[model samples]
Target: MSAEGSRAAQIKPFVRQALVCPVDKGPLLDAGDELYNPRLRVAYRIDADGIAVMLADEARKVDEAEHQRLTA
Candidate 1:
């Protein structure tokens, strides 16, 4: 598997339930190493260490198409 995919596999089960969007305080879905919030149109990066950087400043604001893709 790709590195990101591998990382996701390792981190998803441990962190998925605990991840939340720091901006909107909403649940996040695992999108590779990023945790995405469809409602907020943002994605938070998971570090190589398997820790999520959930800070708002660390979040990436996705466009509508990307949001749809991530959510899908």
Candidate 2:
């Protein structure tokens, strides 16, 4: 990310509300700096611009314990 794009650390409320899992088309939870899809146990990183990295291939797989925490 460029320095200019790193200005925001939080996703805009409206943007967050509109975000969904690219794979499942399900709602995503704003888990700090990442968007988590608890149903699929995957997480997408938030860019420095506070935009979601919504690519399915780039999503990180959540372990069972981590999934528990994310959902909790």
Best by lDDT: 2
Give residue 69's lDDT in candidate 2 (0 to 100): 83
Native-referenced Cα lDDT, model 1: 0.76
User: Pairs clashing in candidate 2?
Assistant: none
lDDT of 2 by residue, 1-72 (tens): 442333223566677678899998999876767888999999899776666788999999999999888788
Kindly list the per-residue Cα lDDT of model 1 for residues 5-24, writing each as its tens digit.
Answer: 65455675656666677777
Q: RMSD for all candidates, in order, please.
A: 2.5, 5.2
TM-score of each: 0.78, 0.82
List candidate 2 stretches off by more than 4 Å.
1-9
